[model samples]
Target: MNYKTFLINLDRSPQRLADAKKQLDALDMSFERVSAADGSQLTPEERACFDKNTAQKRYHYDLTWGEVGCYLSHLKCWQKIVDEKLDYAIILEDDLHLQDDFNKVPELLEQLKTPWSFIKLGNPFKPRKETPVETLARFNLVRYDKAPSGTCAQVVSYQGAKALLAARSLFFRPVDVDLQWQWEVPIKILGLTPYVAGHNLSFDSDIQQIDQRKNKAKRSGVRLREQLRFFYHSKLRGE
Candidate 1:
C-alpha cells in the first residue's frame, strides 16, 4: 500500500519521540515526526479557530488550552494529508505503543472494497458496540454504532482529510469528539480490532493533567450536562 506515516510529538517531549522511534525502528516502519502544537504557544491566528461560544453550547464547558492544542496538532496532520495528496496516512500520537501485528495494517486496509474515510487503529472508550465489516489475517475492520474516542491512532484517506477540512475552519470540540459527529463530516468511521496499538501508560499525558487542573473546580452539573449533550447527538441525532 502507498501511504505516509506521521507521528505527532511535541518538541518539549524529546524522550517520548526517542521511545517512539525505537519502537517503530524495530518494526521497520518509516514515519515523519510532526511537532505538536503547544497550547501555551498558539499564535493569534491558531487561537482564532477555537470557537468559545460553540464549545460552551455543544460541550457544556470551555475547552482547556491543552485540548485546543491537541485538536490543532491533529489538524496539522490532516492538512498535510490533503496538501500532499497522499492515498492515506497512519497518524499516531506519542503516547501509543504499537502491537506486533501493526505491520498487517496495510494488508487489512487493502481488503476493503467499499468506500471508507477513516479507520481507527485501536478501540474506543468503554461500552463499545462494533459490527464486523471485514476480516483479515490479523485484524477485523468494524464500524461503530457509537463513535470512538481518542486520536491515538488512525488511518485517514485523502478524501477523509478533504472532508474534514471542508467540514469546519472553526472547531468547538476536541478532535476525537469532533470525529464522532459523522453527520457533520459526513464520513463513515471504521475501526480495526483486536487493536494494533495500545496506550503507553508509562508516559504521563500532559493534556489529561492540564484538563484535570483546569476543571478541578467545575460543577457537578457540568458533567451531567455534557453526558446529556453527547446522548442527544449520538443517539437522537444519530451522529
Candidate 2:
C-alpha cells in the first residue's frame, strides 16, 4: 500500500543520516527524517515524568538521559501517525541495513491475511514460544508468545499507535519494553523472521557511548520475577 516512512535521526549524527540515505537511495525508497529528541534536551517536566513513570526500576538500574530521550523520540513518531490519521507507517531508526529486496516490503504488506496493529520487520533474538509461522510469499510472520524487542524497523498501524500512546500515557518503561509487554497494551503484534531489515552493527548507539551492560548479579532476581509473570500471563492464563 501507499504508506509513509519515517526515519528517526538526530541532528548531531550526520554520519547516520548519510548512511541511512545511502541505503534508502540504493533501494529507491523514500522517507522523511523525523528529528530525534536528544536526551539532554528534556525539559524539567519531561525529566520529572521520566523519573516518576519508570515501571521497571528494579531492572532499569541506571537509565541515562539519552535513553529517555530516545523513548520520547519514538513516542513523537507514534503521535505523528495518530495525529495524521494514516492507516499505517513504516518506522525505522537510522542504523538499518536493508536486505537486497527490501524495497518489495510494501508488496508483502498488501498480501497480509489479517489486519495487524504492529509488525516487526527485523529479526528478534528468540521469540518466547518457538511457535510455527504463517508463511507469506517471501517471509514468515508469527504472533510471538512474547512481544519481541528492538525497534530497529517495524510497521505500526494507526490503532497500534493510539494503543501504545494510551497504554504508556503515564510512561515508565523503555520504549521497546513498553511495546513488548503486549498483555499490558493488548495490541496485535506480529514478527517477521529472516528480517527484511536489520541493524548495521558498525554504527554505535546514540543513547550509549560505551557498552550498556546490566549487572547480571543484580538482574537475576528481577529476571526471575519477570519470567514467572510472563509464564503466568502468556501460558497459564492464555492471554
Candidate 3:
C-alpha cells in the first residue's frame, strides 16, 4: 500500500508502546510511532484551546484535561498526514490486539469503490444500523449510521484528516464522542465488519479519565438538565 501507518504512543507509556510494536511485528506491518501529547504536560497556549465554557455548553460538562490531550493527539496525526502529503494513513492507538488477517489491509483497502474520510477497523460497540457496501475477501465494508466509540484503529483519508482537524480545533468532548457528531464534521465515515483489530483485553485505558462528580451532592434540577442534554445528543441527535 502507498499509504503510511502511524501509532500514537506517549513517552511515559513505553511498556504499552513496546507491546503494540510486538503485535505489529507479528503482523509484519511497519509503522511510525508518533509521540502522544500528555495532558499533564500541556503548555499555557495549548491549554487555551480547550475552552471550558464551550465544552460545558456542548457536552453538558467540562472536558477532562486527559480528554483534551487525547483529542490533540489525534489532531496531530491528521496534521502530519496533511503536511507530509500522504494520500491516507492507518492510525492505531497503542493498545490494540491485531487479528490474524490484519496483514491483508493493503489488499482489502484496494477494494473500496467509494472514497471514505474515515474507515474504522475496530468496532468496540456495534452501530444500530449498517448497510453492507462491498464484500471483500475476509471482511465486508459497511456504511454505518453512527460512529463507533473507539479511535483504536482506523484508516483515514487525506481529505478526512483535514476536515476532522479543522472541525475539532476547539473540541468540546472526548475524541470518540466528538467523532459521533457527524453533522458537525460533514464527512463519510465507514466501518469494516468483523473488525481487523480490537482493544487489548488485558490492558486498562490510560487516556480516559474517571468522573468524580457522580459522588458529589448536586441539585436535582441540575442533574435532570444534564440527563436531558445527554439524551438529546445521544438519542435525538443520533450521536
Candidate 4:
C-alpha cells in the first residue's frame, strides 16, 4: 500500500503523458513524472551522456542505446524509492492507459514479495491471459525464448532495481538495440520472471513493426552456438 509510482515521460509526447495522468488520477493513484531531458535533478555529465546516447532516436526508430536515457530515469526513481525506504514501486511511461476500475495495488504488492522478478502492464499487443498471476518463472538457461511483450506496466522491487543497475555496467553489448523488450534479456539473466497476465482494461493495440529483414523470423545460428559456448564460459568462470 506504500509504493511510489514513476511516470517516465518524454517532453515530445505531451498528449500521451496527459492521457496517462488523467487515467491515473481517476484511479486515485498519485505519481511523479520524470523527464530524462530535464537536467535540474541530474548532473551535467549525466545529461550530456544521455544526449550523446539518445542523439537520433524517436518512438519507433530510437536505437537501443537511446533507451539508456529511459533506463536512467528508472534508476533515478529507484533511488528515490530507496531514499524514502519503500519496498518497491510501479513504473509507467506516458503511453499506458489503465482499466477504469483497476485497483490491484494489494495484489501487485503481494506478488512482489514472491520470488518473481517483474510485473508488466502495458503492451502494444492484445492480452495473452486473463488471470492475475500468482507465480511466474525465472528463465534459467543460455537460450532464447519467445516471451510475452509489453513491459511498460511493471512493479520494480528494491532488489530488482539493484539488479537492473548492475546490468547497466556489466552488459555492454549492442544487440537488439532497436527492438523493444530487448531489456528482457538482461532481466532474464538477472533471474527475473515476468508476469504472463493482464487486467480487463489496458492500453494495448495490435501493432507490430514491419520486419524489414526477410529473415527476421529465422534464428541466428548464433543462438545455438552461443549456448554451446556457455559451457566453456561457465567452466572458465567455474560456475
Candidate 5:
C-alpha cells in the first residue's frame, strides 16, 4: 500500500530522535519527523490552543497538564498531514520499535483499511483470542491479529483521520488519555472497532519515565481534578 509516515518528535530528546530514525530506516519505511513545538511553522489557531492554561495549583497535576500540553502542541502536525492530503498515515511517537520484517506491513495496512476506519498496529496488550473487530465511525478496535502486546501500535485510514479531525476540538485534555478514550470509548460509542497489534511494534515502559514514579497520576489527583472532568470522579470516588 502507498502511504505516508509521520512521527512526532520532541526537541528535548536527541537520543530518542536518533533511535527513532535508526528504527524507521531499518524498516525501510519512508517518513517525516516533525517537532511537536516548532511554533514558527504553526498556524495562529494552533499556537493559541497550545498556549491556553487551565491554571492548576498542584504540581503533579501540573505535570499531567504539561504532558497534555506537549501532546497538544502537535496538533498542527496532524493538521499539516491532513492539509498535505493523504488517505491514511502511520503516526508514531519519539520512541517506538518495529518487527524485523516490518517493511511488508503495507499489505496489512491495505487489509486494515477495509473493515475499520482506523487500526492500531502496536498495542501494549498482546493478542490472544480472535475477537471480531467492530468498525467505529472512523476507526475499528478488533481482536489481536499481529502480535501479543495488544497496545503497541496503531493504524488510521482516511476515515479515521476524519474521526480524529472531528474529535480534534474535543482533545483539550491529556494526549495519551484522550487517545486512549478516543480509541476505546468514543470509537465504540460511534461503533468503530478497535484493535491492537498483539505484536511489539512500539514500546514505552517505566524505564522511559520522565518522572520515574509510580503514583504520579494518583499524586496528581488533588490538583488536576478540575481538568479531569466530572466523569473522572467515579474512578477517584470509587463509586
Candidate 6:
C-alpha cells in the first residue's frame, strides 16, 4: 500500500482544488497536486505531442484542445510514477466525491494475489459487462470486458505507467478512450465496484464545455465516422 497520490487541478481552478483537498484531508490521505495542463496555454513542447491530422484520422474528428491538455496532464502523473519508482499511484481529477470506504482501497488491493496494472476507483456512468475477479470486504474487483469512459480516479501500477508512457507517441484519442484500447497498452484494466468515488457534479466541467463547442462544428462525415466506430467497437469487436 505504499503509493503516491496525485490530484490534477488547473491553476485557475483554486476552488476545485480546495474542494478536493477537503475530501482527501478527511480521509487522511496526503497527496501531491499536479498542475493540470491548460489547453489554451499549452507550450510548444507540450503541443508537439498532438497533431490535428493524426487525431482526425484516428478518432474520426478533431480533438478539442482541452482533451489534448487533459491527456498531457495524465502523462505527467504516469511519468512521475515511473520516475519515483512507485509501486502504484492513485491519480485523481479535481472534481470528485470520495466515498467513506475509499480509505479501504489499500486493504482491497492487498487481497489480490495476482498482478494487476490498472484499477479504476470511480463509478461508470452506465452499467458495464464485467466478470468478478475478487470479493473484498466492501468492494468487488472486476475485469471490465469493455472499459468505461472517465479518468476521474484510478490506481495505476508502475507497469501500467510504463506501458502508458511507451504508447505516448501514438496519442490521438482522449486519455480515457485510449485507456480502453487494451491492445495498445496490452494491459487488462480492472474496476472496483461498487465504486469508492464518483464525480462531484457541482462544478461545471471545462472539458465538457470545450467538447460541446467542438461537437457543434463537427462535419457530417466526421459524425458518421464516429457513429460507425462506436457500432464497430461495441457490436462487432465486442469491446
Best model per lDDT: 6
* lDDT for residue 45 in candidate 1, whole number 0-100: 94
Task: Point out where model 5 deviates above 4 Å.
Answer: 38-65, 125-130, 134-152, 170-172, 182-239
User: What is the C-alpha local distance difference test score of candidate 1?
Assistant: 0.83
lDDT of 6 by residue, 72-174 (tens): 9999999999999998999999999999888888777778876799999986476678888888766788887678789999999999899889878548778
Q: Once model 2 is optimally superposed onto the true structure by TM-score, how far is the C-alpha of residue 148 displaced, in angstroms?
A: 2.6
Q: What lDDT would each prediction earn against the true structure?
A: 0.83, 0.76, 0.79, 0.48, 0.49, 0.83
lDDT of 4 by residue, 1-239 (tens): 46788887766557667888888888888888877433234355654444323222212222233334445665666666666766777776665657643455435346443364444544445433333333323322121232334445666666666656555532222222212233433453111223322332433321112122233333345446544654464455443
Q: List candidate 2 stretches off by more than 4 Å.
A: 51-62, 124-133, 210-223, 237-239
Models, CA RMSD each: 2.3, 2.7, 3.3, 8.6, 7.6, 2.4
lDDT tens string, model 3, 52-78? 776554455566666777888898999
Q: How accurate is candidate 5 locally (lDDT)?
A: 0.49
Residue 219, model 6, lDDT? 58
The local distance difference test score of model 3 is: 0.79
Where is model 4 poorest over a 10-residue stretch in terms of lDDT?
204-213
Q: Candidates sorted by lDDT, descending order?
A: 6, 1, 3, 2, 5, 4
lDDT of the structure predicted as candidate 4: 0.48
Q: Higher TM-score: candidate 2 or 3?
A: 2
Q: How high is each candidate's TM-score?
A: 0.90, 0.88, 0.87, 0.56, 0.59, 0.89
- Candidate 5 has a TM-score of 0.59
Q: Is candidate 1 or candidate 3 better by lDDT?
A: 1
Tens digit per residue, CA lDDT, model 1, 149-219: 88889999999999888886889878887887787776788988898887888999868755553663444
Better of 4 and 6 by TM-score: 6
- Backbone Cα, N, C clashes tallied per candidate: 0, 1, 0, 3, 37, 0
lDDT of 2 by residue, 1-239 (tens): 44689999998899999999999999999999999978767787666657442445434344567777778888889899988898888999998888887787788778778768898888534555534357776577777766667788999988899998887655666677767668787676787666788888989888775224352124466668776776787776464
Candidate 5 backbone overlaps, count: 37
